[model samples]
Target: MNKITIFHNPRCGKSRETLKLIQEKVSDDDIEVVKYLEDVPSEEELKNILTMLGVKAGELVRKNEKIWKDNFKGKDFSEDGLIKVMVENPKLIERPIVIKDGKAVIGRPPEQVYSIL
Candidate 1:
């Protein structure tokens, strides 16, 4: 089986739930849980994830996040600029992104991971 990776924030309930759902469907060895808050994704990595998720950089942002609202809201950033911001502020990225076999989904509902799996 291919590796399944999840960009997880352990403190977030949705992230934790999504991780648990992935665990139920996949073996531990096949799963990689990323604590993105501590180990942020690079701009390039965020771009790749954006590709996998089939979304633009801004689409992956957690707009409701205080960091985004207080700092980045109402700003018009280029695609690369948004990606850079997400790299610098991982909290602005959406929760529980699951990726496998070149496909990805934002696991807001947790069940979304199944589509990629």
Candidate 2:
């Protein structure tokens, strides 16, 4: 089996659900949970995960966040700029990104992680 890792924020329901689903599919030992807020990734790591997710920086953003609205809305930023925002404010990054080997999925409905598994 492939190594599984979940970039989780416990406060989010979708992230929790994704964790539950992974438990059903595999043993706990095989799944690693990264509490992203406490174990924050550097800019380079975040960029690599985003690339594995096959999405642009915008797609991985929680734009509804007040921080995003207050600072980033109606503004044009380069890809690097957007990534910097997510690195600086982890909340702005989308929840429940599950990575398996070289592949990754955003567990939006939680079920989305199933495909990558």
Candidate 3:
């Protein structure tokens, strides 16, 4: 079976719910949970995730986050710049991104992970 990876945030309710749903579908041994805030992804890795998610770097960002609102909001940033910002501030990256077989889904509602699973 393919390894299922989840970019999880233990503190986030949606992320926790998504992980539970993933656990229901697959065994713990098969799951790769990445606490992205603590173990931030590199620029290349972020780019790969964006490709898998079929979205731009900005699309993966949580614009509502205080970091974005306080620093990045109203700023004009290129795609690479946005990626850099996310790398520097992992909190800006969206939560509970589940990946399987090179495809990714943002588990905003938690149930969104089902489509990829």
Assess every candidate by TM-score.
0.96, 0.95, 0.98
Candidate 3 C-alpha lDDT tens digits along 1-117 = 999999999999999999999999899999999999999999999999999999999888899998899998999999999999999999999988999999999998999999998
Candidate number of the best TM-score: 3
Q: Looking at model 1, which ten-residue stretch has the lowest summed lDDT?
A: 108-117
lDDT tens string, model 2, 75-109? 99888898888889989989899999889999989
Alpha carbon lDDT of each predicted model: 0.91, 0.91, 0.95
Question: Could you tell me the lDDT of residue 32 within candidate 3?
Answer: 98
Candidate closer to the true structure by lDDT (higher is better), 1 or 3? 3
Q: What C-alpha root-mean-square deviation, in Å, does candidate 1 show against the real structure?
A: 0.8
- Displacement of the residue 59 alpha carbon in candidate 3, Å: 1.1
Please give the lDDT score at residue 75 for candidate 2: 92
Quote the lDDT for 77 in model 3: 92
Give the 10-residue window scoring lowest on summed lDDT in candidate 3: 58-67
C-alpha lDDT of residue 105 in model 2: 94
